[model samples]
Target chain A: MTAVLEVEDLTVRFYTEEGVVTAVDGLSYRIEAGETFGVVGESGAGKSVAALSVLGLIDSPGRIEGGEVRFEGEDLLSMDESELRSVRGDEVGTVFQDARAALNPVYTVGEQIAETIEHHLGYPPSAARDRAIRLLDRVGIADAETRYSDYPHEFSGGMCQRAAIAMALSCDPELIVADEPTTALDVTVEARILDLLAELADEFDVAVQLVTHDLGVIAGTCDRAMVMYAGEAVETAPIEELYYDPKHPYTAGLMSAIPRVGDDDDRLPTIPGTMPDPIDPPPGCRFHPRCPFAEEACTRTDPALVDPETGEAATLDDDRAAACLEYTEGLSGGLDYSVEVAGGTGEHVEKTIDERDEGGPDE
Target chain B: MSLRRFVVRRALSVVPVLFGVSVITFGLFHLTPGDPVSQLVALNPDVSAAEEARLRERWGLSGPVWRQYLAWLSNVLVGDFGRELRTGRAVSGILWRRLPETIVLGVFGWAFAIAIAIPAGIYAAVNKGRLGDVAARVLALSGVSIPNFWLGLLLILVLSLYLGLFPVLPPSRLPLYHPETLRYLLLPGVTIGTAAAASVTRVMRTSMAEELNEEYVTAARARGLPERTVVFKHVLRNSLVSVVTLAATLTAGIVAGSVVVESVFNWPGLGSEFVRAIDRREVNVVMAITLVTAVAVVLANLLADVLYAVLDPRIRYD
Candidate 1:
């Protein structure tokens, strides 16, 4: 599949009074045509900043330190203001988290959508108004013709999200970046919104960059997922593989934390500690301080993102890759764990490992 | 609570307010130590006791305070605001003649303030923390700090006295549309407008700065709209709710400033007329002018409420 967007070594920093915050540090990823790529991380992992940097929306004090964000072979980072304007709404539409605030309160939702159409497509007011109504109907808002005149306050939270989605699809953009589109919505509405997003992505043949902190959201909508830790992608793999066979320790910790229906555990397990300060992150592996599988070498060597089976740096085309010392054999003490694979035939294959050798540590 | 009903209710509510204002102003003037008859007699000793008593009877000053207030209130309700004691002219007629002059000055000052404040505010907000913003802050500070009367004196000194760009005293009775009359309006208009513009600029700058940081602004920019579109269409529109409120207050300020400004420029607006009426102890004229000003302040606030509904969709009069 042809890549619609190829982001390489995208770094973003914020010059705050406290110190320089390395928001997105050396992040690299890609989204192919019609694919749904999810970037999942805890808050402050720079998911939103990295996505905004793609559209060149970072304001003052926050700068894109260095990066190559190529959209259809055109370098977006190098584009001037006018050029970026053409790419922003026309080429890549954005759906912000707060749909209510994302819309202008003074203008009708229809007028706002029509404004985008008029600006990018140069459609006349009459034609743009009709197009906006059709777009609104396509996003599942009933009585679109009449609702087009209603202000944003007249729309409910779910309807606002639908309106926002309609707006993003107004110009038939090649890509859509939805930053926590359904976060403000309730659970039932969130499920419907996610389903609608997936349906629209397929229908328009548009690549999507879905940024969220919810792993369940990523699993429900994304075809491939990248797990970011401390502004870096620690693991990226197919959805099923990432969920069932997570390679990195962080990913494993995240998966195990999900509460299954029949489980009777009194307290849910949680990863120890919070995200490190971006201004002064720990040396070597950024996650070493909180990682349960950390070893002496894990504190001394930062592992590169690599194919877990071969121990080599993984390229963009790799289907599965993780960044961990255990994968690269850099850890003197190997990780001791078991794989319980739930087979499709209802059979379970349990592969257990013996304890680490008590001999002197292999340097 | 439709907008029509809401407006009618607000208008109805103004009756008690005006009544309260009229009663207070009338009572304060009457309750003062010196009586109008006594003052008139003292000013002109050639008047005999019979003439003084006749004057008191003519002006209906020989009664209890409440009875006098009720007499005036009844006349006002019937649309005859009584006669000015000093001029023996109908108070309503005097107000009608002077109203336009004050309005002309007030409107010009208001126009000047808005014209200066909106652009200066937008510039300062867009270039926040820059040299332009610094200069705008300093200008606003000076505007708010320096009284309009002082500013009026300075403008007259520099622009009128030194440069001879305008006359020291405006021509007595020229129509407002005449070029000669408009030229006479410049210094006083600028004087009143400058102080208000300074306040408005500061409010606009603050409101614009806050609105620019809103998520909608960021979203608008992300849609590939031009910077000009984002700033003018989205940012400015949102900021107007607050700015409109400040503008209403500035309108009242212009009216108040016109009192001193008109006196200084020798302009024949209601402000100067009101001042002259107060000095002469023409109780009827003073009460009428006070009521007019009270109504003006009330109407300005009403306009602000209406504008609030217009600018913010979430704010319903209902």
Candidate 2:
């Protein structure tokens, strides 16, 4: 498989009145052709900012300081405004976090999609409208031809997201940056939306950069995933590997924190401490304040992403890599954690990771 | 179909509002210390008490407040505004003659306000806090603060006296629809529209600025839409909803401003007639003008309500 987008050493900054905030620091990731790449993290992890920077969408007071966004071998960052405009809806489409808010209130859903089609594909309004209706119907909006003239307010949250998804796919772009596409949706609706996204990504042969805070969302949809914490990726691995055997302590904490359906415990195990302020982050490691496996060295040594096998610096091609002192400078106490996959076969009741064996599920 | 229903419902709702306004005007007239008959008697010293009594009976001014209001309302409904005390001329006829002039002036002012305010507001919003925005804001501030009477005089002084652009007297013989009258309309139009333009510009700026930040704008931009399309097509539509709301209120300003603006322009409009009627205490003429102005303001607000539903799809008139 070939890489469709290669975002390297991306750094985004916001020049706020208080101070300059380094929102995304040296973030690096890539999405291969037709592969769903997940960028999972807690809130304020700079997922959306980094995604926006790919399209050169950062406005005043916020700037994309440094980045090489190579989309199909072309450096998008070097492109001028007009050049970027040609690439935006033509080759890359974006679905905003808030689907309803992302849709223009005054315009009909079909018109909004058709307009992008008209602009990017050079189709006339009639052709664009037909294409938009078909796309809307394909995205699962019932009576899409009739809903063609319906305004955004007339659509429910789920329907709006479906329309937004339809819009993203309208131009037949090579890539889609869905920034928390299901965040504002109902719990039941989120699953169906994710399924639709994955199905359409495959159908349209488009790569997706799915940004979400939900690990379960990534686990079910993404082929490969990168776990980000405090604006930095701590681990990058295949979805199953990341879930079954998390490399970073933060990822393990996240995996363990997923509450099980049948678990008797009222309190869900959580990763302690909040995301550190971007303006003035901790000295050594950003996540050390919250890491349960933090050693004395973790407080002093800032680790770069390296291979666990050879402890050498990992390249973009490396499938499994982690940025921890254990993988780089080496932790004195050594890192150890066991993942407990409860139940048998099909759907599991509980699958959580914690320190030590702690025994398997009694059931 | 629903839009038509909404329009009918909204239009029907205006009846009660206009009736209430007419009632208030009549009640105020009735509650005053001297009745119109007595005032008329006082003005003409040669009038006998029997003649005054006959005038009172004829005018139905001897009834209670509600009855008086109803009597006045009944006459007004059928376009009978009584007759001027001094001239003994039909107040309705005088009103119809002056009404068109005021309507033209008001329309010109309204048009001028929209033309200047919409563009100036869009410019300021698109280039917020920049030099153009700052300049537009300053101009808008001055437009709102400066009184129409002062602005009218200044416009006449400069455009009529210094620049030689227009004459002080409005074109009298030329039909108002004639092109020559338009040139004469400009001075007072600008004078009346200045405050409204300023008021609307501020609203447009704030409304556009807010809409510019909405996610739809960024979404539009993300779709490879030219920056122009994002700002003009998407942002402008959302911003106009607020502008329409403010437009309704600015009508009051323009109407009130016309009163002063008319006198300064020496335009034969209802506003100038209103001033004369007040000065001479022509109770019939004054009451007719006041009721007309009140109805106009009520209608403007009603128009705004209808426009609000049209501009924003979420607004349903249930």
- Model 2: TM-score for chain B: 0.94
* lDDT score at residue A234, model 1, on the 0-100 scale: 95
| TM-score for all models, in order of appearance | 0.95, 0.95
Runs in model 2 lying further than 4 Å from the true structure: A343-363, B43-47, B63-67, B162-164, B170-173
The DockQ figures for the candidates are 0.80, 0.79
Query: What is residue B11's positional error in candidate 1, in angstroms?
Result: 3.7
Worst 10-residue lDDT window, candidate 2 chain B: B168-177
Task: Give the Cα error of residue B251 in candidate 2, in Å.
Answer: 0.4
Model 1's lDDT to the true fold? 0.88
Expressed as tens digits, the lDDT of each residue in B1-318 for candidate 2 is 377788888899988888788877877766678866776678789999888878887766666667777787788899999888767899999998999999999999889888999999999999998999999999999988898888888888888899988887744557888888888888888888888899999999999999999999889999999999998899988899989888888888778878888888888889999999888777778889999999888889888888878877777634
Residue-level lDDT for A248 in candidate 1: 84
Deviation of model 2 at B100, angstroms: 1.8
